[model samples]
Target: MNFNKIAAITITGTVLTSTGATLAQTTYEGDEFMGYASTGEAVVVTSISGYFYGDYSEYRDFTYTIGNDYIEGTALCAGGGTKWIAEGYGEYEAQSEATLNMVRFVCEYEGELQ
Candidate 1:
């Protein structure tokens, strides 16, 4: 093939790859939360603090969109005092003014203390 054709193909491939990566996942850090969003699911880490058992603990919220509906929940971690890591899952209800109703979700999470 000609050099021009090869260059065009290379550029097209690069653009496609970058676009797919961008759509697959995104992450953010804010004053109150750190979060990441994937194709159908999102995770928000809202709080991290010292706990009785270990140096730190983590609390997270999550959301997953399904069609026109969505599911949301929270997760908490209670450190093992020495291992510095923990895992837990829970369900909760959230109020959305737009929907004028309550939504419930189940969440599972794991974290390590810094």
Candidate 2:
């Protein structure tokens, strides 16, 4: 019987046991993390529009017009629902010789905010 062989076998078994213990602990921690994430707020898709008429993920027929005082717009949302009456503002850089501007808007469903 070789002492070296016995020592090597013992060491291998110890390493494998330690690795298994670590893996079990990590798995438990991962499950706990997933449970916490699931409880948080999530966006639910209320409905899908343009199911058969068109692509449900694409917005179409969007139109906007700018006036001196206000900006008005309307669009067919991907869910097939119509989104209109978006309110937004524009930022202009007067110092820049080139045209530089940005517009941002928030749309309400059915033109109403709940």
Candidate 3:
């Protein structure tokens, strides 16, 4: 029947539209810092040498298949040490700027002497 065919087409179109929206990609970039702390230290760690600093950037292409409320994508860093990774969590954010937040730790290395 004509009514049945039209109903099926409508449902199909709605499904496709929603799928495309959820699969959309977003990118974010900001300064990043990488560092480690002692397990037994009770003192607050606040020194320039304590942490290696740099820029953090990433591309969130799709939702992670195995996790809840998580996304996976490529990540990059720039500054004293340059590094890249194929897959990383998209929910890392140390400080918020605009609509995106700065990644906490994408890569780690010894910073150059000033």
Candidate 4:
């Protein structure tokens, strides 16, 4: 197996598999409690819009250190019909105006700032 010790054991197993994928990145390195503010209260915004749903994602520029003023609202489908215009911060988002089968992002971010 001596091809220079099998090329130094294949370069030390490719540097320990790239340092165990950078220590197994779990994404949102902020220790997600939904990043703060939004508690275990669960979510909802479906006063009638076909029971809403959610799943919006954000991390760009990454400044969500916990802003309770989680603004960016305006999605009113389920009869009132306004359906998404501003979203992305934290707490509640991902209720895509009813395509059903489930991506459920019925939305709310006002539960933060406590």
Candidate 5:
């Protein structure tokens, strides 16, 4: 991957609840990492399904989930030959089951990754 490419990602969604339908929208920016992967802000669409919208298989393809996501020790930053994370974390309603969290990762690279 070219480390010099900077991208902005956005996500939008809503939650199905008893009280009423809830809407959620979040955007994140990639923080530059001089010579490594960039950091990003959290935009959780929901607890489990919201965070990863691209494809669950994609993460499973490229990541190793340690344990319950959100738990600091349970989740490890994956990708690249080394593990790195965005500048932010995903935000979800722990007690709310009908909520959706959308998370976007903005990657700001510096050098080429080969």
Candidate 6:
């Protein structure tokens, strides 16, 4: 094969490979059901905490959107008597069918984390 033709073919294959990897990391396909809540089911709280088995735990806040309806809440994890925070979005096609699509999550930490 000529040098130019071989180079072009290598580049095309690299591009396709990278594109597939990107999609695989960002795609989700599965069914995971976790209970359900009725409308107008909410409570006021000063703070929230949960038990997570780890030395470090992150608190994630999730935001879901479906047409005109949307839901937003915090994802909490407690460990080492302290809370860490990490933020990201969710991508699950089946979840969109059940309720709103979880678009994103953002978290902020206050005080010093132990």
Error of 6 at 50 (Å): 16
Writing each residue's lDDT as its tens digit, candidate 1 over 1-114 gives 112211111211332232211111112222222223323323333332221212234333434332343444333433321111122334332323211111111112223223
Which of 1 and 3 is ahead in lDDT?
1
Clashing pairs in 2: 49-79, 49-80
As a whole number from 0 to 100, the lDDT of residue 76 in candidate 6 is 44
lDDT of 3 by residue, 1-114 (tens): 111211111211332232211221222232232232222212111111111111223222222221122234332433322222325433332222211211223233123223
In model 6, the Cα lDDT at residue 64 comes to 32
State the C-alpha lDDT per candidate: 0.26, 0.21, 0.24, 0.25, 0.23, 0.27
TM-score of each: 0.21, 0.18, 0.19, 0.17, 0.16, 0.23
TM-score ranking from best to worst? 6, 1, 3, 2, 4, 5
Instruction: Flag regions of model 1 displaced more than 4 Å.
Output: 1-54, 66-68, 79-114
Q: Return the top candidate by lDDT.
A: 6
Off by over 4 Å in 6: 1-33, 38-54, 65-68, 79-114
TM-score of decoy 4 = 0.17
Off by over 4 Å in 3: 1-68, 79-102, 109-114
Candidate that would win on TM-score: 6
1 or 3, greater by TM-score? 1
lDDT of 3 at 59: 28
Taking the candidates one at a time, how many backbone clashes does each contain? 1, 2, 0, 17, 14, 0
What's model 4's overall lDDT? Answer: 0.25
lDDT of 4 by residue, 1-114 (tens): 112211111211332232111221111112123312233232222221221122213111111222343333444434323234434633433343221101122222212222
Ranking by lDDT, best first?
Answer: 6, 1, 4, 3, 5, 2
